[model samples]
Target: MSPANPVAGDERRRLVEDVIQRRILSTELRPGQRVNESRLAEELVVSRTPVREALLRLEGQGWVLFDHGRGFVVTPLSTDEIRETYPIVAQLEQLALTSTGPALRGLAPVLSEINGEFGASTDPARSHDLDARFHRTLASRCGNGRLIALLDRHWQALHRYERFYMTHPDDHRRSVRQHDAIVAAIASGDVASAADQLVDNIIGPMHVLLERLR
Candidate 1:
């Protein structure tokens, strides 16, 4: 029997979703930036239908807002939103680590790979991608699809701030050191220490970003 085709309409939708998400997260598509359907369709090399579908999905996720007559625009990252969301994210991430403590041994190779990537990366964008992948891998192991989905949504919302930090030279170095610490804690099976490191790593950058914004 032939292997099943992996690229289906669902795959197209996911691709479109990723394109819109990357643009928004990278701030290439900034807050209040209007999404032109035809232009995005051309840029993404997809039909307008898929682009529209992706925008609708983002709208539902609070990453985009549609006005009655204004169509869709990237949502602004309000200080209040960050204040409310980061704490919940911290709790969820800690819970995931605590729940998955037993399986963390399997994650050593992945952690090592991430460490190597972070150590070798000099480009801001590449470094941020590896950092995101490392955290997402950990969260995915929580084995709760709902929790993963929730965290994914929050991460999308927080990506703008993350990108800012990733591009800043000092913050980038500190971030790598923090990730190194978390990896060490996890590798040593110190769940409490890992959880503490996770919270500090997330909240520390967030606090700095908020202060800078203010």
Candidate 2:
């Protein structure tokens, strides 16, 4: 495979990265699965160079790991890793909510509408995307540029776990309920309470997965 246009190298790399990321998170490319650059180039209709560039970036993000002799493989995912990440993200999200204060009053209704759409959506991937959007919307109001950037980085890692949870019927129902509580707490300008709800919404599922792992 060769490049469509030399000038579009960066764009091709980015496109390949996003598709590969999605495939990994969706479990289409399972953990530890070896990546074939020539196959990817053929499948994605691009040159091997962009796939190489994309894998380099993904390796940096911990989405894939490269072996000097073996090229790249999807990184293993585990409940333990997600269990460690959820509480930290929850705390940061809470701090962001607190920083927003009364400015959050109007956001509840919008969140509620999104929550409704989330609950009704039967597509697991769409549901997962909506769930991330719900939190990212709140993160935007955190008013701390650096923290938002950090949270955004970790959010990508969290998506695979979130997608797992979205596949569980009981978990989806619980998510909707927790989202309601979170929205209500935020709408009332109770940052501490809203933060607590946020923590429960995230860490609760992680704990469930942990128990299952045990």
Candidate 3:
């Protein structure tokens, strides 16, 4: 028999990983749920090998954990995760903003436009997406690719938490107000103030999220 194609195998594994990660982010696969490799393989219409590979990848990314007796399980939600993840993201984003130097002012108009859309969005999911785009645009002018990449990694980990919080209209409104402050600071060329406001924007919701988890 011919050997399996490595390229095809890799694509299948990535496809499986994307589908499983999306489910986890969307909370379709709730925290602490057991991940059935065989069942997922059948559902995804792929073989067990790719499913196993994908689960291992997800494990590395902190989306799931491996257990000898129980197999893979979704990583449970915890206040500790929030405490650790939020500050790192806040600091990284602040550094990214400061690194933009004189060019940060140029991004204010774009940032304001995105924030306006985010405020008008009524759907939690839509709001979450727009909020992410607003942040991405805020940091777009920063020349440090490595900082952005690291920020994105931790930022993705916050998605489940952020998405959960977006359902509360009051909390989201606070975020919109914070975004406005950050934009105003940027437009005025007050890098220090903008960085402070940006940190507030990133870390403020964290308090509410932690309280909810507790």
RMSD of each: 4.3, 2.6, 1.6
Best by TM-score: 3
lDDT of 2 by residue, 1-214 (tens): 9656766888999999999988987889998898899999999999899999999999988899987777799887776688788888888887887788667877888899999998898888988988998898877776799889878887877777788788888888899899999999888888788888988898887887777656
Best by lDDT: 3
RMSD of 3: 1.6
Clashes of each: 0, 0, 0
Overall lDDT per candidate, in order of appearance = 0.81, 0.85, 0.90
- lDDT string for model 3 (1-214, tens) is 9998999999999999999887887788999998888988999899999999999988988889987789999999889989999999989988889999888898999999999999999998899999999988877889999988998899888888988889999999999999999999989889999899888887888899988888
In angstroms, give how far residue 177 of model 2 lies from its true place.
0.4
Task: Output the worst ten-in-a-row residue range by lDDT, candidate 3.
Answer: 19-28
Enumerate residue pairs that collide in model 1.
none
**TM-score against truth, every candidate:** 0.82, 0.92, 0.93
Write the candidate numbers in order of decreasing TM-score.
Answer: 3, 2, 1
Clashing pairs in 3: none
